[model samples]
Target: MISLIKLSEEAFTLYRDQILAIEKASFPSPWGARAFLEEARNPVSYLWALRKGEHILGYICFWMFAGEVHLLNIAIHPQHRRQGLGTALLKKMKSFALSQAIEKIYLEVRPSNVAARRFYTKAGFQERGRRKRYYTDTGEDAIVMSLELLDRSESCAERCGAAGVTFSTSEAQKDLEVSKKRIDLPF
Candidate 1:
């Protein structure tokens, strides 16, 4: 059974190795055990894991504060790339953000990571800015991408083509049916 669930202490304990492996494989310089542990303890940080039965497949972590979400990390296992898992995880993230009154979601990626940059753009994220030498590992410039989850004047449908998806900062859409082609939302 494939499922997406919050990474509880029990799950983290059981799958720490796998999760860490995914991170290491997905990035040039990955977070170590301490970083994951710190995030788990942070009140504003949320980490979610996607699993297939007992095997961990991927995860997403983010910080939510002040009407914004800063996506700290997200990665799908190498073997699972291009299977729509990334899109599903992103949809879940967007839904959760909208419910929490978050107005925007932001993330930074290496400018050289064209694949990730493309994915974010397809998911409705726009290049907001660039940071000089954000990645300490290789001194690579990071491109900031942002997604507006809600607007005061327009519906999400108008901006991203979710059709009936509409919400304000105060009210969140309870249900968002994410369709691959039907929904214009990038991920």
Candidate 2:
């Protein structure tokens, strides 16, 4: 069974090495262990890991500030890709943003990452703009994509409540209703 857990200090301490291994395998330019530790310590940052029992499948890290949410990084284990885990993580982030009254969610992707671009487009993100030589390693430009979280008539909270959407925090694990047979895990 897969579960989603917020990255707390104790959780990070226990899974630091595994998380770093996933990061190294999933990204061409991966964040180092120190970077991950620093991010975990940042007050404005939120990180969550998708796990099956004690084994982590993936993680999403984001920064929340001033009614905006920025997706800093997300990666699935190489062996677990193409199984809809990324989409699940994105939906979880969106739900969290809506619950927190965030206005929009945005992220930067490498222009050459066609698969990621397609995925973001399908997820309702539009290309807002670009940054010149944003990546230091290869001097690659970044494509900025953004998705608005609210509509004119109703707030996301209302919509979510009406839809009977349920999400639990790190402190409340028992509140989540999970299924072992399903390939995708809930947020």
Candidate 3:
């Protein structure tokens, strides 16, 4: 069974090495321990860890500003990739965004990451623009994607068109309840 938890300072202190290990394994240009620590300390950032029992399966970090959410980083452990955990994390984020009245969520992906692009596309994120040579490590162009969250009364399927994004409204509500129990930091 997988569970999501907001990464608190105490949790980070306890799982520092494990989190860094997963990061190094998942990303070509992984954030270092210090970077992760700094992000955890940032007031604008929110970090969440997906776990199976005591084992960390993945993590996501995002920044919320001016009625928008910016996905900073998200990755599932190599062993956990291709499962539904990524989608689950995204649904959780969407639920949280709606609760906070965030209008949109956006992220940049490397053009070389075809799988990520496909995943984002299937999740109803439209590629709106690009950044030339945005990746410092590889000088690769970045694809900018955005998803607009409709009003609660509106169906996501209508706004999403044929993107085929399917998230359970009940699941999102349940996630919201779980989040209320787990999230402790002031936003």
Q: In candidate 2, which residue ranges exceed 4 Å CA deviation?
A: 151-187
lDDT of 2 by residue, 93-166 (tens): 88778767788999999998898899899878999999999999999999999999875355544333322223
lDDT of each: 0.74, 0.77, 0.74
Model 2, residue 115: distance off in Å is 1.4
Higher-ranked by lDDT: 2 or 3: 2
Best to worst by lDDT, what's the order?
2, 1, 3
Off by over 4 Å in 1: 151-187
lDDT, candidate 3, 1-187, per-residue tens: 5567767665665567888888898778989877877877898898887766567787889999889999988888888788777776787777678768898999999988898889889878999999999999999899999999874664543332222222221112322322324332122
RMSD of each: 8.5, 6.0, 7.1
TM-score, ranked from best to worst: 2, 3, 1
The global Cα lDDT (0 to 1) of model 1 is 0.74
TM-score of 2: 0.81
Model 1: ten consecutive residues of lowest lDDT: 164-173
Candidate 3: list runs displaced more than 4 Å: 151-187
**TM-score, predicted candidate 1 vs. hidden true structure:** 0.79
